[model samples]
Target: MAGCGFDDLPLTRPGPPLNAWGLYGEGDEYGRLNLITAQTVQAGLREAKEGITINLNLPLDTMPLNPTRAPLRHEIIHRTHCNDDHVSFNTQGSTQWDGFRHYPYLNYPEKQQYIYYGGMTSDEARDRSNHRCGIQNYAKKPISGRAHLLDIASFLERHQRSPLSYFDASTPIDLETLESCAAESRVVFKPGDILIVRTGWTEAFFGISEEERQSLPHRQKRGSCGVSSDPEVLRWHWENGIAAVASDAVAYEAYPSVNSPSIHETFLAGWGMPIGELFDLRELAAECKRLKRWTFFFTSMPLYVNGGIASPPNAQAVL
Candidate 1:
C-alpha cells in the first residue's frame, strides 16, 4: 500500500471510485502532498538557476469572479499618524487552493450524503473544534516543488491552428493536448511536481472592460475553458506523480462538470489533492516562453485558518 500505482486505486475497501483514501495512511491529512520529500525539494531548487521570480497571485482587490461570493471590502482605520486597514473577503474569491474540505463527494445522491477526504463527514468538517483535514495542515508545511507549465492555449494555436473560441467558452483541454504540450516544451514529469496550466482565462478576463467584467457573473450560459475531468486525466495525473495542479480557469476543471464524479470530488475529497484556481499565470507563461524553460521552482503558503476549507494561494515561481 505504501508504493501503490494508479492501477491499485481504492486503497480502502468499499471506497469511492478512483479513490486513494489510505494510500498515505489512515487519517492521512496531507494526501498527495506526501510526495514532496526532501529529495523533491532539492530537485525543485535546482530549477531556480536564474534569480528571476514571478508572482502567481491575482490582486486581492480583483473583482469577485464568482457571483455567489461577496466582493472584497476594505476599511481604513485612522490612528493619528498611523493608519490601519481592515480587509475581509472570501478566501476563494481570487487565486486560491481548494482544500480537502472544500469539495466533498456525494456518497448517497438520494440522501445527499457528502463526505470529505479521509472519510470526514460534513458534520466533522463544519465543527469549529475539528481540524482533521483543514487547510492549516498545508499551511504548516506549505507547498513547494518543481512545477511545469503546459501553456495549452499557446500549444493549440501553434500546433492545431485552432485558437479557442473564447476563454469563457466550454472548451475542454484533453490529455492528448496536455501530453503534447509537455513534449514540445521538453518538460519531464517527476514525482512531486506541481502542474501549472495556462488556458488564457485570466489574460482574457483582463482584456475586457470593467463594465463587462462587472457583468460576467450575470451572463447566461457562461462557461470556462479548463482541463477535462475525464477518468483518464486523473489516472494520468496519479501515474505521472503530479503532487498538485493549478490553472487560470475558474474551477480548474471544465465548468458545469462534463463527467460524473467531477475532478473536484475525486481530487479534493477522495485523494486530498489541492486544486488551485484563478492563478495569474499570464506573466509566468510569458517568462517561460521568453526563457524557453517551462520548469521552475514553485512555492505557496496558504492562510493558517483552523478548520478552513480554502485559502488564497500566496504563490510564486522562481526560475
Candidate 2:
C-alpha cells in the first residue's frame, strides 16, 4: 500500500480484463472516491456561479419499477394527532445510486472471487465491523466535485437525421459521439470530476400515459443508450481519474452491454466504484443550454443506512 502511485495501481489484475482491487489497499471500500480530495472540492467551488441549484432527484414514484426489480409499496399509519407514512422500496426503485454491494465481479469462473467486487469472499461482505464495502461510507463523506454533464440525448437530437429513440439499449454510445457532445458543450473534463450523462431514458419513460406505463412488462429486454460497453470506455474512466459516472438511464452502460461488460461489473464490482442513475436532468440540461455551460458544482447526500446496498441520491447541481 505504501509508495503506490496511481500508475502502479491494481498491482496486478487478480481478475481478468482489469481489476483495481489492491489499487487502494486490501481493505479499501471507497475506490475512485479517494480521488475527490480537497483540490477537487475547491475546483467544484469555483464552478458555482449563479447559485442556482437544480434538483437532480426524480420523484420516487416515477417509474418506481422501471428496471422491473421491485415495486414500491406504501401504507399510512394514522396516529391520534398525526399520520405517518410507511414506504417500502428497493434502493434502485427511482433516482438512486448503486453501492459496491449491489453487484459482484461475476465474469470469473471462481465461485468465491466472483461473489463481489475486489474478489471479495461472501463472508467479507457480511462480516461485522464493516470490513467490506458499504454505501454509508459515501453517506458519511459525500462526493463533492466538479460535475460535467454530457447531454447525449440533446446532442443526438441535433445531429441525427431521424428522430432518436428514447434509448438504444442495443447500441453503445460510441466514444466518438460522446466526445463530440463534450466538444459541443465546451465542458472541460477533469480528474475527480463527477460526470452525469443524459440519454433521455427517464424522460421517455415518464412521457407515457399512467395506464400505459403501468401496463408495460417489467425488465423488458429493451435497449437504452449509454456509454459504449467497450474496453476503451473503461480505459477512459481510469485514465481520466473520474470519481464516478452517472446517467439518466437505468444502467449507465448500454443494456445487455453491447459486447463486453460495462461499468456495472467493472466499476462497481471490480474497482469498487459507485454510480448514480435515473436523475432528472430536464431542468439542469435546459439551464446549461441557456447559460452555454455544462459544468457545475455537484453534490449528493445519501442516507446513513448502515450496511445498506443502495440509497436514493439527494443529488443537485449548483451553477
Once fitted onto the true fold, the runs of candidate 2 whose alpha carbons sit more than 4 angstroms away are 1-10, 66-68, 110-113, 123-131, 161-164, 167-169
Candidates' C-alpha lDDT:
0.87, 0.77
TM-score per candidate, chains pooled: 0.96, 0.90
Residue lDDT tens for model 1, 41-126: 88999999888999999988888777898878999999989999999999998899999988888763432578888888889888
| Residue 218 in model 1: lDDT | 78
Looking at candidate 1, what is the lDDT of residue 182? 95
Summed over model 1, clashes come to: 0
Clashing pairs in 1: none
